[model samples]
Target: MGLQTQLRRAIAVYRFVALGYPVLLGALAFDALQRPVAAAALVALLIGWTAAVSYRYTRNGYEPKVVYTDLAVTAAAVALSAWALAVSDRAWPISLGPWLAGIVLVWGAAWGRRSGAVAGGVIAVFGMVFRGGINENTVNEAALLVLTGFTMGHLVRLGVEAEERTRRATERDAAARERERLARDIHDSVLQVLALVQRRGNEIGGEAAELGRLAGRQEEALRALISSEAYRHPLDGRRDLRELIGRHAGESVTVAAPATPVRLPTATAQEVAAAVASAVDNVREHCPDGTRVWLLVEDDGEAVTVSVRDDGPGIAPGRLAAAAAEGRLGVAQSIEGRVRELGGTVQVVSGPGQGTEIEMRVPRPREGDADGDAHRGR
Candidate 1:
């Protein structure tokens, strides 16, 4: 059950327990009492209110306004105790005695510490007003009421927060289990089929060799997607962009980065890395096998810029527009989409004879960010 429901039930139980004190005290002092019928009627009213509040609060919905009303009713009753009760040589105990605590708990459950404290103070004030002045007993009761309300209010807050955390953790655990089941199924069937197609297509030649390469790429990507315990990129914490870009180095690709770490938030770094991967993939798909590619990462104060350069026959004017028209979105979506999503920009520099260069710029993480990853290039 939620914290509010549990607290309401506890308050209900306390109301019943505390109700006995005033009823018993008043009954024992019946002979010396003033206005016996009114006292009996007030006790019955308290009973009816308790039962009604308990029934309503135990159900699904709750109205915060009810707490305020409850406090007002209890205060009015306490304030009238002086005129209603017998004024003999001995001082008669008030009707609500410890039952006042029920109001405090109700306030705590509905709101929090501040409301609880206010309820406690108001209850104490009404009680003192009924007695005409303050005394040792009144002081002690006031302290108890205030402290109990504050403590219970703080506990309710902590309990609700813990319950929310537990719920989120359970959801994440269930999602992970579902993903693992799907991964097992894909590994057993689709991965094997793709591997077979790649091998057999390579055994044949001509267009089959191209088909084999495509199948191999799909198999590699699918395997990585299922096995990695991360999102599209590792975004759990801080990461160095330089380390991620360096992974693209190969026989035909060279990476140039600053001597110092170009630190960025995990999400920003991963997005930047994903965009770079898309650019490298674009080069590999369109250019000749032996074409040289260079990747450079630079920190330009307010922003970080990474440029992917390829020494191949450059893109012709209007070539990208025609490709987009034909629904090919390698450069448009994969490269440009990823960069733009990060609140960054993408610039394509190319011509008919000159080589192509795609530069992506992202805002540098500011100082005092949680990751503490804002950095400059050496």
Candidate 2:
């Protein structure tokens, strides 16, 4: 059941327990004969308050302000019960039995351990003040309230964490399956055609041999792309994009990032890292020998950015558009497509002899966001 449903059920159980308080007062009404009307009025208030709070709890989602107000009212009712009984000289105790303690538990279960502890302590002290002194019964009641609140709060937090883990695992599994399907398609169709073109071009000779070499290189790039573990489940629960992107640094490639971690969702970091890797690959393919590449990662709180730049002779204007028209889809699909899937933007900045830079910016995921859907679709 959902957390709210569990809360509602627990509240219902408390209401049933609260029912006995009125019954107890009715059975012992004769004991309060000195101030019978006052005792009866207190009893009516307790029952009515319980009913009204129960109705409100059933009709709404958790409202902290309202819940806290209920707690205050519950404490007040307990206080009044003690005052009325004391004035009437009743023999029986003025304690609300387990009813008041349940209110503390609900507070804890709804808000968390801290709230529970405060509510328990507050009501326990009030109960002591009304009951004359702190004795074993009151002590036990207070301890139970604190314990129940702390324990239930932890359980609720754990349940929420477990639900989140399950959702992420499901999305991770779906993404893995999709990647596998794409790998199979690439291997069966594109890889086979590339292999045929390479073989035919080699047999025909002349400029065909040069075309075969380019086709062979592309086939190898495609193979490496499919073999990447970027789609696999992340190593840690939270991902640091800096580490993933920094791993690309080599003899000619330099990585620069902040000393502090740039934290992101695992799947998002992985995809961004993969896109960065593709940018690096483009640099490697087009840049002249001895050319150096630099990767810069930054997190400005609102968004995370990774820029891949190479000190190589850059292409003239319309080169990328021309490549796209000629059916070379690396920049379009690998870099731009991957970033777009994450609800991010990728900008390619380059000009003749001015080097190339692919800068990708992905905004930080917001709280309560369903980021798993994006990963699954990828």
Candidate 3:
């Protein structure tokens, strides 16, 4: 059941339990009552109100008018207690007693902490005015009433906010996952067909070459549109690391990823992916023709690892440092820069004729934590 419904039911239950306290109080003071018949009538009225409130709550009576009437009746009953019983200066109201707190709870649950506190104060003030004076006992009772209203209402509000957050997060995850599925479908069908058309059109010259150029532009636009990370909450949604890496697979490149999605936040996934792309680009620029590349994605509970390997002439020992010293910073600025910004590490394993393998290791971002907080451990 929803939080509000459960709170209403709890109020109903409290009404039934609290009703007995006043009944016993009324019976004990019946002989001493100045107007015994009226006191008995008020007691019966309380019983009927409790039963009706319980039944209405069960039937989903969430109307504000019920709470209003309840507040009015409770206040009225407290006022009448002084007239019905001769013991007017007694510590508690003869007609209401603990039963009055139930109406305070209803106000708190239906409205919020402030409204509940107001309801409690209103009841206590009405009781004090009717009973002629506010003593230590009456003040204590007022404090208790206000405390009950504020605490219950505050707790209910907290639960409602928590539920809303959970619901929104669930919807966002679902949307991102569905979009990932659609992207794969488009890549497998529409993207491949467009690529084929562009290649064939270019092979046949003249007007066909111009058509091929147009086709290529359209294909790029469609691909970018489908893969755009322009979300309203851009950094919030999760994207599959697999989908980003899988797009690089071709005749000379092989991609391997977990059977299930290796999901990460949109920004983190995109950054990691851009880092991978940079590595592959570096390979293509320097390596010989027909050099093979492999991309591997691993999700090992605590962290995500993406590895790019190439069977090409390897970087000579200290060559990257020499290149960096000469201001040729392709590896440092693009690959290492992107990964380090995401609190990840990059290791380049290469020597002459050993080929090159670059590994990027990043701890999974902790849910509901800031980037700095993720570094602080979950």
Candidate 4:
């Protein structure tokens, strides 16, 4: 059952003990007949306290002041019971112990160990002091009050912590399942179309041959991305950007980065890496097969900078604008769009013979920053 439910049941049990205490005390105190007025007043207070406790705490909500009130009333009642017994002619001690002890246990269960200890300590100390000296019964009652309050408080805290851990685990599991479902969808449709375009374009020959090769390269990149450990791992929104970027380095591609790790939120790092990969793919499709491409990663603890440069023939004037107008969006959607979503800037420099250099810069998000997704199509 839930922690609240358990506590309500415990409150009911304490209330039951409280209801019986006055009647039990009347029977035990043979001097009760001698001090009729004091006996009646004490009994009346105990009965009223029991009803108040039940009405305030048995259901859902209760104010913090109610607990303090209960403590004050309990302390007063214990003191008065001792006074009533001392004035009576009877030599017997009345067992008014249960009323205070029950309240201490309830406080402990409600507020945890420290609150419990305070409430329990007050009752135990006051009870012993009013009785004159510390005896075996006094020591046992004090020990019982301390132990019950602290133990119940600990149990309540443990239950709360366990529930929190379960909630986080459930969220992680659900996120992982959602990612797998999306990967399947992308593989079944987008990846297949890219692959088919590559194969058919190659068979058609001429200008279509170059277009097909570009599509083929993109298809391979997408396949590797979807199957990568970085993609398959749970989306925690934090990861090492250095690891993701390093995956693109092989053969004609060279990666230069610091020895230390470059960490970033998972979505931001992935989008940056995807943008760099798209730039490299452009180099392979347009430049010679053996052309060298250099990728540099730098992080100065404020922002991340990535530069992709290739020693290949650069684009002529107005080529990018012309391509955008014709609805070709590889550079727009794949690179610029991704970085823009991350609240960053991108610069592209190329001339007829100066080769191509694309630089992307994104600031490191502030700690506990409440931003949304850094890029779409994750």
Measured against the true structure, the TM-scores of the candidates, in listed sequence, are 0.72, 0.68, 0.56, 0.63
Per-model C-alpha lDDT, please? Answer: 0.79, 0.76, 0.80, 0.77
Per-residue lDDT of candidate 4, residues 1-378 (tens digit): 666567767776776676576566675655545665777777777787777676777665345788788888888877787766443654434647666667776777677777787788888887787765488877888888888778767776777667655765687678778878888998999889988888899899998888888888777777777787787774565778878888777888899998998888777888999899889988887787677899999999989999999888888889988888999888888999999999888899999878899999999998655234222111
Error of 4 at 234 (Å): 0.9
Q: Is candidate 2 or candidate 3 better by TM-score?
A: 2
Which lDDT tens digits does candidate 1 get at residues 136-212? 87877889888878877778777776776676567557766777888898999999999998999999978888877
Q: Write the per-residue lDDT of candidate 2 for residues 244-268, one digit (tens) a residue.
A: 7766667888999999998887778
**Candidate 3 ranges beyond 4 A from true positions:** 27-36, 53-64, 85-95, 226-228, 231-378
Clashing pairs in 3: none
Give the poorly placed runs of model 1, Cα more than 4 Å off.
Answer: 60-62, 86-89, 231-378
Give lDDT for model 2: 0.76
Alpha-carbon runs more than 4 Å astray in model 4: 1-5, 18-22, 28-63, 83-111, 131-133, 204-218, 235-245, 250-378
lDDT of 3 by residue, 1-378 (tens): 777777778778878788788677767866666677877787788788888877876686657787788889889888887776544445545646688798788877777788889899999998788875687767877998999889877897788777766776886688778777888888899888889889989999888876676677557755864776632234466788887777778788999999998888888988888898889878876887688999999999889999999999999989999999999888898889999998999999998898999999988888764332211110
Which is the leading candidate under TM-score? 1
